[model samples]
Target chain A: MLELIVISTLNGVLFGMLLFLLSSGLTVIFSMMGVLNFAHASFYMLGAFFGFQLTKWIGFWPALVLAPLLVGAIGMAVERYGLRNTHKHGHVAELLLTFGLAFAIEEIVSMIWGKSPLDYRVPALLDFPAFTIFSTNYPAYKIFMLAISVVIFVALLLVLKRTRVGLIVQAALTHPHMVGHLGHNVGRVFMVVFGVGSALAGLAGVIAGPALVTQSDMAASLGPILFVVIVFGGLGSLPGAFIASLVIGLVQTFAVALDGSLASAFGPLDPSTGPSVLTDIWNVTIAQVAPIVPYMLLVLILIVRPMGLMGTRES
Target chain B: MRKLTLAIAVIAPMLGHAASAEDTIKIGYIDPLSGGGASVGEGGLKTFQYLADELNAKGGILGHKIEIVPLDNKTNPQESLVQAQKAIDAGVHYITQGNGSSVGAALSDFVTKNNTRNPGKEVLYFNYAAVDPSLTNEKCSYWHFRWDASSDIKMEALTNYMKDTASIKKVYLINQDYSFGQSVRTDARKMLGAKRPDIQIVGDELHPLLKVTDFSPYIAKIKASGADSVVTGNWGQDFALLLKAAADAGLKVNWYTYYAGGAGGPTAIKQTGLDQQVFQITEGFANSGNKAAMDYEKAFRAKVNLSLWYPRAVNEMRMFKAAAEKANSIDPVKVAAALEDLKFEVLDGGTGIMRKDDHQFLQPIYISSFGKLTESEPFDEESTGWGWHLVSRIDTPQAMVSTTCKMTRP
Candidate 1:
């Protein structure tokens, strides 16, 4: 039992950290720009495809740096031409525009990448087991993923607290009217923040691509899960997103790890003694319960703490 | 002016020679070139293009060059209808169907309607990938020819194999929550009851399309249900994700899956490190000792720089070419007649004869288990040191006669 819990927790943390790498950028972008970039996951997909192409030529290390830069540049162009023009039409319009952009980008990706999963390979350097828990070998790449996510989180916190540009961006997020009145380039700040947020998403893609399987349709597959994390984490709170992502990840992991049936829990009560409905639902497993944990958490959080763990009400 | 006159003069003879041909052989290739089904569509397209190239290389079909018109359905039913009309407008006599059952169903209706509207230019539809039983059974159209086995036929073979395995007592069923999945699940249930009544069904679950990112919950349920085996009809990412999640959860149950040929192929198994746990079913093409299949695969990989396991599209194209040649004409009605009566061997050594009863081909299916890398070479790999070994080859005859409509002549 202890071994199962330990392994599940470790696996949960690893997956949670990966989710955080994605959710953190989404939260920051949402908090600052107030428009959810529906195409964020699509850009992440492009990063993976781009990284795979680059890795074929140069190697994983160079691809890691180049992929995000390319994705960031694309994000900047999208912001300048697509989002900026749509911004005047209100947040809902911006949201719809990004949604349309996501669809268009998915089609473009298919056109270029040929609608198949790129046979992307994990870097040979990190292709060994990091350690074993309960005799289960955990890959070293997962540990690297967790480490990179933590480093990014710390770096982001430091920049937000200490950097000059961070202060201006923070001011625009909190006091947009005041920042504009101060004669600061709020639009430029928005563009930069959007670029950085997208770059972070791209970085996550480059790292997670081989692990998750780089495919043209991966964006559609992972998009909703990321959205669920964001919504469950309290919309625009980074810390909330972090906690929610980990919580959801752990819930699923633990659900898979634990094993006990409702019938077993009830001491193998006879079906004749119980109602047909109760008897029918008796043999339930933890794996069956894992997927519902996120949605359950979402409901619970919305009911008990609508503002999220570290979030404040807009009003 | 002299240069322009000279260029026109040079092209005029060739243009006149091409135009003076009796008629154009318009062959249409319809597939999901966009959206989620594009992976299969892209592969099918490449295979068809290869066949077209091969035919052209052999001095064309019936001594006239084959003009292949490829149309993208975008994995939408409505869009497929539009594309089918466009193909008809472009004067395509025979249409080659692509991946996805939904798109196939839509095109089946469109082709029937076209046959009714244009009596002279009948459009013969050759289905390569859509494996829904309804296309051959409940919704079988006279204009359509299905090259792939239906869900019921495929599941019958799988269930027959599972029935004899005494170790597989309790069974858990999970599939994608869609028409294709539902059809497979229903067939599985019927086949299990009919074949192995002793086998107990513990649980059955359906996950929404592209929504099952984590399958740990379902895996846990299967483990808790004490099921000795689990059956899934999931494909693509869902299949990959479910297999990985089940392995990660340490679910100690045998998994029987139909759609593992695409995403869980030998390369995927090597990459994901789940090669030892996955079992896959491949079409007859997998066992074909024919040099052409290997040569086609080699040439395809060289041209596309990617690997594809399912070569139904290429095989279907070959079948189409054979039928056209036998008829010695590009007329759809005549080609359809010739195809129904034709008896030929596919490159895979499987008999490619279309049963006169239902117009379905008798093909072979391969069942293989995932295991450690064996030194034995099964097929040519771009690189050595890794490949899947075949456990068994089940030569099941998929006779569509059981489901063919009475209206169609044998």
Candidate 2:
């Protein structure tokens, strides 16, 4: 039981941190621009494929740096030519535009790489076991993932919170005309924010592609859960996103560790005699319903508090 | 729905008869050509197209060219019905699909309903890889023929092999939450209990299908249970991600899976360096020491850029031809009749029977372990420098199981 708790905690924290790393860019864009970049995950995917191809051309180390840069550059171009024009048409237009980009990006990626999972490996340098929790050997690659996630979170906090550029960007978001009158390049700031947001997503993909399966559908699989995290965290709050990520991650992990069911909690009843829905609920173990916990929480949060756990604004 | 079916029944045959005059036999290939399941679907599509080309090269079936009309279902059951309707409108007599059993079930029912509504215009649904046992048993249709072994049969064979292995004391079950995965879990538990009551079941887990990105939590639970073996029916990204997570966490346990031979499966297994520890139960593998099958596999890889992942597809196509020839017609109803109780040599050198009772194929199923290859095992998967070493072979009798299918003939 002790081993279960300790190991589940470790795994949950690691997974939670991965979730954060994945959605950090999305959070950044949504917070600053108030327009959800639906293609953010697609940018992450581009980073992964770019990372894979660049790793082949150069190496994993060089590719890690270059992949995000390329993704960020592409993101900047999209913002300048694409999102900038669509911005005047309101959030729906922006949403639809990004949504379309997501599909187009997925198709293009498939055409280039095919629908196969790339044979991207963890660099030999960090492939060994970092430490053992009980008998389980946690790879150094994971420790690196956790460290990178934390560093990026802190770095992002510093960039958006403490820096002069951060202040100008935040001011530019709500008061673009004022920032323009103050002689700051408002349009350039917006472009940089989107670029940095996308680059962060790309960085996530570069790191995560090796950790998880790198395929065209990687974006779609994680897309819904990413929204759940952002919404549950109370949109546009970095710390909120972080906390939500960890909470959901921990909830899912701990739920998997528990084998409790309705039958176990109450007296034994014949599950087969009941309707399928009732039987399903009665027979289902907590481990089986771990995936549903987040959505359940999403519903609960929406019902209980629409502003979410940490939202400053009511939506 | 009945009204729509009647409308289609009236209009579809006119277009169907017009297209049928072109001297081409069309097989509508419906599966997920786009989305998470697309990799497996695309591979299946390529395999069937190759088979169609091969059959065409051999003077075609009854001098009518075998043409495959590809349709993307996006792995949705409703979308599959729409695609089926589209195929029927375009005059396709035969439709084959194998991915999600839910989609398979939907198509099976749709084909049956379509055939009933449109008497002279019938379509046969040939399933290559959807192995939900209910499809061949309680939900079986005269119009639906399965080339793959049911999940129950595979489990029976798997447990028969596991009954002798004394090392597997505690077994863990983790599968995707769906019809096929649920069947694998229930079948595994039931068969294991009957075969080896001494083997304690440590954990039985079912996660959402293709939704999980990280599997460390599941791996941690498996470690906590102290299981010596894991049995899963996870495929595509699910299988690959699970194995990769197991590798990352350094979880050492024998993996007995339903689809560890999928596209990225071998690469993930190789990365783990788990030499021959992962076992999968399938109809056949590349390095089964069969010369003709090996030559075909080589040629297939050279042409398709993919390993021969679906030996059952090869069986399905060849058997379809044999049935067509025996019936001496490509008419769907006559062909369906000819397919029943038909016997043909499978790709891996075994005579497989298409059982008349449930329209299920009875053939030899092989259990192979992916690991280091020997001189004799010439073919490796996904260029991993490792291949499937034949561990055990369950013959026709061992692989066969009784069915309860009650079909009403057209």
Candidate 3:
């Protein structure tokens, strides 16, 4: 029982860290732009694909660094040329534009990558087990993922809190007009923030490509979960997004790990008696419904806490 | 809704069939062309087109040219129904689809309803890969003819192999949560129990179909359960991700899969470094010693830049041509009638027969494993060094399972 809990907790933390890597960029971008970049996850996919192709020629380490830079450049171009033009049309237009870009990017990726999962293997150096607990070999690649995520998180916090670029970025978020009046390039700051956010997403994807299945729909699969994290953590709140990512990751992971079934809880329900929704529910194990927990939490939050746990905005 | 509309729009051009001096046989190819299922669909389309060329090279069926009208359904059932309608409207006498069973089931019902409503404008449905047994059993239709082995038949062969293999003891079941996955789980349980009473089922896990991005949690559970082997009917990304998780955690166990030879499967198996641990049950593998089939595969692969993933597509086309010749007509009704109880030599050196009662093809199903290329093996999927080696081949008589289909004749 203790081993199960221990293993489940570690796995949950690893998953939570990945969710944070994806959602952090989204939350930051939303906070600064006041527009949800639905294409954020697609940028991550670009990173993964770029990384896979790059890894083929230049090895894993270089691809890890270069893929995100390329994706960030692409993200910056989208912000400057695509999002900037649609800005005059209001937030809805920006949202719609990003949404359209997401689809376009996915189609483009499919054309290039052929819609199947790529063969993005972990480097041989990190393929061995990190540690073994209760006869289970925890992979070194996962520990590497956890370590890199932690470093990125710390680096992001440090850059935001203790640096001049960070202060300028902070000012631009709350007071773009004031910052412009003070003779700063507020537009450039917004562009830079967008680029960095996208770069972060790309980095996550580069690492996650080998960690998960890197396919054309990889973005579509993780996009909704990132939204759930941001919304549940309170949209536009970086710390909220962080907490929410971990919470969701743990909730889903632990839910799947736990062997609690409805029948175990209720006791003695014969499915053969007749057909009933209760019977259906009775036969379902907790793990079967783990995927639905995030969506359920989303609905519950919308009903009870519209702004989310740490959200500053009503939405 | 947009997907459905887009599918119709894409299919609109192919709907206009102009009668010319040289009569042509139009076969509408409907499957995903733009989404996650596109790779598999693209391979299927290429195989169909290649077969059409092969058929045309040997003089067209009944002296009518074979033209495969390719349509993209985007892997959606509603979109598939729309595409099917467009195909029928375009005067296509034969339409084939095989990727998702949901899409297959929808097309089956739609074709049945369309044929019933308008007997003269009937279209014969040829399913080349959707293995859901219900497509041949409870939901079997006279308009639909599946050219691939059903899930139950494949599972029966798989379990029979398991029963004889002394190494397999504790087993686990993991699959996508859907009609097909549920059917696989049920069939595996029933067959395994009946065949090997000593085998203990350690764990059974089902995740939402095509939705799981991370399978570490599932793999952790599998490891904890200490199962020696896994039975899964998962395909596409689900199959890839599950195997990846196992690979990462170094969970060494035999995986018996239905679609492990599907689109991203070879890559996953290679990444896992499982060599011969991963097993798949299918109609044919690329390396199975058939010189004619191998030569054709080589030519097709050279032209299309894809491995020959579906030998059944070749079988389906050959059978269709034979049936068309037998009936001596391009009429859909006659071809389907002739297709019933039809027997033909498969591409990879085997005989397959269409069961008249179910319209399901009963072919020699082979249990193969991924391993290094040997002297006899000539091909591999996706250029992966590893090719599928034939572990066991259950001939048609042994692989055949009784069907409960009650077909209503048109």
Number of the top TM-score candidate: 2
Clashes of 2: 0
- Write down the TM-score for model 3: 0.95
**Per-residue CA lDDT of candidate 1, range B198-263, in tens?**
998887776666666655445555665788788888888787667655555555567787776674
- The local distance difference test score of each candidate is 0.74, 0.92, 0.87
Which pairs of residues collide in model 1? A287-B217, A287-B218, A287-B220, A288-B217
Output DockQ, candidate 2.
Answer: 0.80
lDDT string for model 1 (A22-53, tens) is 77778888877787889889888888888899
Instruction: Choose 1 or 2, whichever is better by TM-score.
Output: 2
Can you give the DockQ of every candidate in the order shown? 0.23, 0.80, 0.61
**Candidate 3 per-residue lDDT over residues B236-267, each given as its tens digit:** 88898889888877788999998888878889
Question: How well does candidate 2 match the true structure in TM-score terms?
Answer: 0.96
Q: How would you encode candidate 2's per-residue C-alpha lDDT over B1-410 as one tens digit per residue?
A: 99999999998998886665587999999999998889888999999999999999999998888899999999999999999999999989999999889998999999999999999999999999899999989999999999998999999899999999889899999999988898999999999999999999998999998878889889988888899999999988899889988988889899999999997999899988989999999998899878889999999989988899899999999999999999999999999999999998888888889999999999999999999999999899888899999999888898988999999887
Better model by DockQ, 1 or 3? 3
Q: Rank the candidates by lDDT, best first.
A: 2, 3, 1
What's the residue-level lDDT of B360 in candidate 3? Answer: 90
